[model samples]
Target: MTKKIEVLGSGCARCKQTTKVMEMAVKELGIDAVVEKVEDINEIVNRGVMATPAVAINGKIVFSGKIPSLEEAKALLSKS
Candidate 1:
């Protein structure tokens, strides 16, 4: 199954960094996944994320409030 991964933030540096990490992890793992950036405040709040730079895998929030390391992202992707 293809994983639906979302990076939520306001297009800031942290958010971009998270997106990059997620993309690299997906590429390295050779996983079928769609990574998207959620910049809309309403959407982010509706998703129940109180912090920016959050990560959601398959519609479930996995990480939030900080940028994750490459290995951390890889592990998250692997689980998905």
Candidate 2:
């Protein structure tokens, strides 16, 4: 199944970097998935994310507060 991956933030540098890392991880893993960025604060708050540069997979928030490394992203994807 194609994974639904979302990077949530305020469109800051860290958020952008997180998005890039996620996309790279996806490409490297060759996983069937989609990487998307969510900049809406309302949505982010509703998701209960108290930090920027958060990642949500399959509607569940997996990582937050900072940009994750490529290995971390890959590991997160692998588990999801």
Model-by-model lDDT, in order? 0.95, 0.97
Q: On residues 1-80, what C-alpha lDDT tens digit does candidate 2 reach at each position?
A: 89999999999999999999999999999999999999999999999999899999999999999999999999999999
* Candidate whose lDDT is highest: 2
Name the lDDT of candidate 2: 0.97
lDDT of 2 at 3: 98
In order of appearance, the predictions have TM-scores of 0.96, 0.98
Best by TM-score: 2
List the pairs of residues colliding in candidate 2: none
- Enumerate clash totals for all models, in the order shown: 0, 0
lDDT of 1 at 11: 98
